[model samples]
Every structure is written in C-alpha cells, then in structure tokens.
Target: LRRKRSSVLRNPPPLTTATILSKTYYNVNSHQPESLDWFNVLVAQTIAQFRSDAQHDDAILRSLNNVLNGPQIPDFLDEIEITEISLGEDFPIFSNCRVIPVEEDGIGGGAGAAMGEGGRLQARMDVDLSDFITLAVETKLILNYPKPRVAILPVALSVSVVRFSGTLSISFIPSSPPTPSPTTLAFSFLDDYRLDLSIRSLVGSRSRLQDVPKIAQLVEQRLHSWFDERCVEPRFQQIVMPSLWPRKKNTRGGDDEDVGHDRR
Candidate 1:
C-alpha cells in the first residue's frame, strides 16, 4: 500500500512552465477587450461587494479587518508604501485607495468559541496614489484603446485583525480603519509609459483567503506577461514613445562661456 501510494505521488503529473505560460498567454490574448474590461469590472465589483457585504454582515467585516491589520498576513504589506508617481510632466493621480475597517459589536456566539480565547479580531485597509492617465494600446494584434494608467506616487494599504475575550466566550473585534495618507502621481500624453508600483497589507475574503498565496503567485506571473505584451514589447519595437523622458544636460552654460572668454 505504501509503495503504491509512494509511486502514485512520485509521478504526480508534470507542471510545465511552458504549458502554463502558453495557456495563460492564449487566454489573455484571445479575449482581448473583454478580458481588460473584466479586470476593471472585477476591481470595482470587489470593492463594492466588500463594502456592501460588510454593511449587513458583521462576521465578514470582522474577518476583513483582522486580515488587513493583523501581522499574520503576507510580507508584501510593507512594500505598498508609494509616495509619488509621475508619467512624464503631469501631476500625480489617485491620492489614495483604502479598505475601511468594520466594527463587530453584537454578533452571534457559537462560533465565538472557535475564535479561540482572546479579544475581538480587528482589521482595516487604505491606499494612496499620485496620478493617472489613459492610453490606446494592443495585445496579440488586438487593440485596447484608452487604457487607463492608475499611478500612485506613494501607495499604501494596511489591515489588522485581533481577537477579544468576553465573560463566557471570546469575541473577535476587528481593528479600526487606519488614518488616510496624502499621495500624488502625474498624468501625461495618451501614450506608452512605465509605472512605479507598490502594495501593502492586502487581505482576501474567507473563501479565497486560503488560496491567497497561490493566487498571488499566479497573479504576479500573469501581470508580468500581460504588461510585457501590452507595454514592454510594443515599446521595445518602438511602436510608441513613452510620455516621460530624461532632461537634456546644459553643457553650454559654464565651460563653454569660459572658452569663449579666453578666446576673446
């Protein structure tokens, strides 16, 4: 039995990066507009859903808060501090995007026992950005007109979760929302550009929480390919000029004047 199980586990089907990449590329390229639209819609929907859901259900809100503010979450939380973002010459976009904490005061108790002996779980989240822009671009020969560039000169997000104890049972009280911070980003021409990105204190829903790590890994891979297809490769081909550029040096000011003076 052990040998049979071991043999089955040993072979355990191959997971080739090429196959995964090909599939991901195909999926991303095939849908084109619909896929891009879905990204926008999904982001909006996620925020809305969390907001609405937390309004009525205290349990969900507490969970969200705990995940955001607690130390148990991912390490990327620290990297999300973005202070400024600039495309070319435009000012920064989006000051900040944040996840507000939910208060749990009078929820049920049977599940409280499972919450372990402690104070209520506390949680919260927030984000800040500097600037934004929109550009027309394409992927796999499919054009995506007016792609939005949401920049954060300095971006930050945070969450905290804590457990509280009552007389009979332990309740979870999510942390209060973190204070909002100011940030800035710049917008320029409707052309190609690279963004300085950051993230902090990201926590997912209960249903998706366990899969967060795996999902994050997959997301990073897909994001790289997606950006490359839509931005990097196109720029490399010189298909479009980036809005931002380095300033030229003023060599004619100091040394050139001295040369002219000496000659005179």
Candidate 2:
C-alpha cells in the first residue's frame, strides 16, 4: 500500500526545455533595426513575470537562491547581485536576473508545481548590465562591440525534491543592417532569431525541466504581445512610406520608337 500510495501521490512531471523549444516559434522580424530593442524588452518582461509569479511561493525562491549561490557559474558567482525590480520601461537593461522567496505555501512543492497548503510567496530580481557584460567578456562568450545590440541568453535552473533555484544571464551585440537581398528591387525580410534560453538544475533535482514547457509558453505569449504592440504595428505603418513607392523604369529606344509608329 505504501508503494501504491507513493506512486499515486507523485505529481505529474514538469515540462522540459527541448520539448518547449520544439513547440514555440517567434515570428518577429529579427533583422530589422528595432529588433534588438524589442528583444531586450521581451527578455525584461519575462524576467519580471517570473519574479512576480514566484512571489507567494517560498520553496521556489529558496530553490532559486541555492542555484544562484552554487557553483553553476563560479566565474559569475561573485558578480551576481539583486537590486530594485519594477515593471514598465524605466530600466532598459537587466544585469543579474534571479528568483527569491518572500513567503511560504503550506504545501510542499518545487519550482513548477502549484503551491500547496494554500500558502503564498513573493519574489524579486535585480539587473546590472555593466557587471553582466564584464562577466560575459571574461568568460569569452561575448566580445566588445561599438554599440551592442540587445540579447537574451538562457540560464540554468537548479531544483530538488524540496527546493528550487536558478539564474538568468543576458548578453548584447552591436545591431547590424539587414542582410542584402539577392535580386534587385525585391525585398526579403528576416524573422525568427533564436533566443538562447538555457535552464540547468543540480543533481537529483528537476525543477525547471518540468516547468520549462509552461515557462516557454508564457514567454512566447508575452514576447509576441510586446512585439506586436511596440515593433510590428508601428513598422508596418512605416514600411509603406511614400519614399519607397514603385518607380517606372524607362524602356529602350526601339520600344519607344515602335510605340510612336504604331500610334501614327
């Protein structure tokens, strides 16, 4: 009976990163000038959502702290710190995004599961772009650029049977012009630049793996909304600018002469 109860009591496994990646797709035009800003906004929004939702779930916060404090990225461990967190467009850069607990749910759960015991928790995160850039440069994952374009990189999440924790890292690169078109006067746009989102967990813990799918979904939805509101609609209006109207190309002399003779 104990074995059967254990089996029955076990919660459904959380989603995995691979599975989440396969199902999500971004239709935004990443090659455009505004793509970088849009990407940054999306990343910021995602980190904010995670931090906000994680509040009222103490277990998740504790788990997140453990992962941040662990040896996952020893090079960056000292550089990590949390500062003021808020929603909206005031702060454009996120340095070190992390999760922390403010309260406890009576029921026991890790990163992904719904809170138990009817208790709630709260979470907050901080970001400092300069420090993040230093760490990325030291790690050789990024290089110096004249004007770095915004980038969102994935971080690993650590989880166990009773605790969950994780860290988020972001990078930036200089924005570049859209790739040139092959044919004259024919326009082709670039879309769907992949965001490198990675989640890692400690031994014997699978907190983020289970929640990855749902987290991916949430991220996709939020980003899609942000792009549509800020980038897509405005750009669509600008694309039809009067300056880009079709021009009539002059034909050869023979064609003009032939038309004149036919008119006579």
Candidate 3:
C-alpha cells in the first residue's frame, strides 16, 4: 500500500503539468471589462477542474494504475491491490494570484527579454491549502511456503504545499525587421514544501519484517528529488502574451510579419 501511494504521488501523470500550462495565459489590455481579472479567474478555474478530476476522473485513475503496474520491485511483495477513488481532498486550493508590472535588468533563458531594454513586467502567484490523501492497499508476501501470507494496510499521506510563491518575467521591444514574437514570459517553481505520512497497523507476520520508518524516508526522498528535478532547480516556462499587437506590413510587397519577431 505504501509503495503504491508513493508511485501515484511521486510520479504523477504528465497531463497534470500540461493542464497547468494550458490555463495560465491571459490578455491584460483587452477591451473586456474583466480583462485584468481573467488571469486570476482562469487560475482558480484550473485548480477547480484539477480537484474534480483527482476526485472522480476514471481516465486519471487508470493512468495511475498503469504507472503502478509498470514499475519492477522486489519478490517479497508479489501481488498489489490498490483502491480506486478520487483524491478529492488532496487537490490544491489557491489563496491569491496577482501579476504586477515591473522593469527587470535581465530575463533568463534563450528568451530575448534581456537583449534590449524596451519594457519588462514581473508577476507573482501563491497557493494555500490542506493537501491530504488516503489509500488502501493489500499485498501478498512469499515466505518460501506453498501458501503466501497476505498483508493489508491503510495509508494516510498529508503534504502541506503552503504558499507556492513564484515569479515570471515578460519583455517587449520594437523591431526593424520581421522576427519571431517575444510575446511570452518564462517562470518556474521554488522550494517551499512540506509533507507527512501515517501507516495503519500491519496485519501479518511478514509485516514485522517491513520497516515503516524506512518507507517514510523513501517517500521523503522521492518528494525532494521531484522538487529538485522539476521545481526549485532553476528552470523556466514560456507563457504567451494575451493581447495581439499589429504586425508590421511588408514594405517589399511580401507577407506581413509581427514586428516583435523582426527584432528577434
């Protein structure tokens, strides 16, 4: 049960990241009355949809199952039985998300925000919520006997991902020739996270051979490794600008192109 829980939480489906990326874009200068509010609303909407899916999405559950079955482990643990249910309560909730415009000296990544100083904007977002998860598991242990011993346990994991603070950089500059649009900003997550886990009493003699603290340590390591590899480890994500600017018309009677792209 512990191993199964680790598999699901430690290595979540790629779709989860994709979902977040798809929902973070907005145009601030649009004529709509709620243009400025659109970013926050969209972020909230993304969280809500993710929470719902974690609770009841069949496809997501199946994906988790596949991930579990795909891993190769020890012989002591033969068969694994995992529970099917929504991780409803474990979903993240946003407290506040705000975007502030500011001028920065440089923008990281190949993103040409630092080439010339036209304009730069800095944005920040934060999330606060109780991240709780529960799973039921059963495994068969082979003890050199005709009949294998079966062990059952319920696992409860509590991860407090409080205050997810991150910053984004955006830059815009005028161009003389047609170039690719610099209409996107890049951002990444930082290392502010906490997690906890509790395993219910074991039910078989084989349970005595299992070390609970060791399992917990493994979970902790997995969590930290994931953060180091994906979040806190200096990386940037590209976000497209919401508003579209007029493209520079072709002077030689060629196809019109975006002025921003010309500069790049």
State which candidate has the highest TM-score. 3
User: Which candidate has the highest lDDT of all?
Assistant: 3
TM-score, cand. 3 vs. native? 0.48
- Residue pairs in candidate 3 whose N, alpha carbon or C atoms collide under 3 angstroms: 55-86, 177-262, 178-262, 179-261, 179-262, 180-261
**By lDDT, is 1 or 2 better?**
2
Q: What are the lDDT figures for the candidates, one per model?
A: 0.31, 0.31, 0.46
lDDT, candidate 1, 38-92, per-residue tens: 4345665666566566567657534544544467644333322222222222222
- Of the two candidates 1 and 3, the one with more favorable lDDT, higher being better, is 3
Instruction: Using TM-score as the measure, name the better of candidate 1 and candidate 3.
Output: 3
lDDT of 3 at 131: 46
Ordered by lDDT, highest first, the candidates read: 3, 2, 1
lDDT of 3 by residue, 1-264 (tens): 657776677754433322433465544333132223455577667777786766665676676566655667565555555653434343343333444443343343344343344334444444443544555455554554455544433333333332233332233433323455535546555445443444342434544444456545665677667655754425444455443544443223447533344521
> In what order do the candidates fall by TM-score, top score first?
3, 1, 2
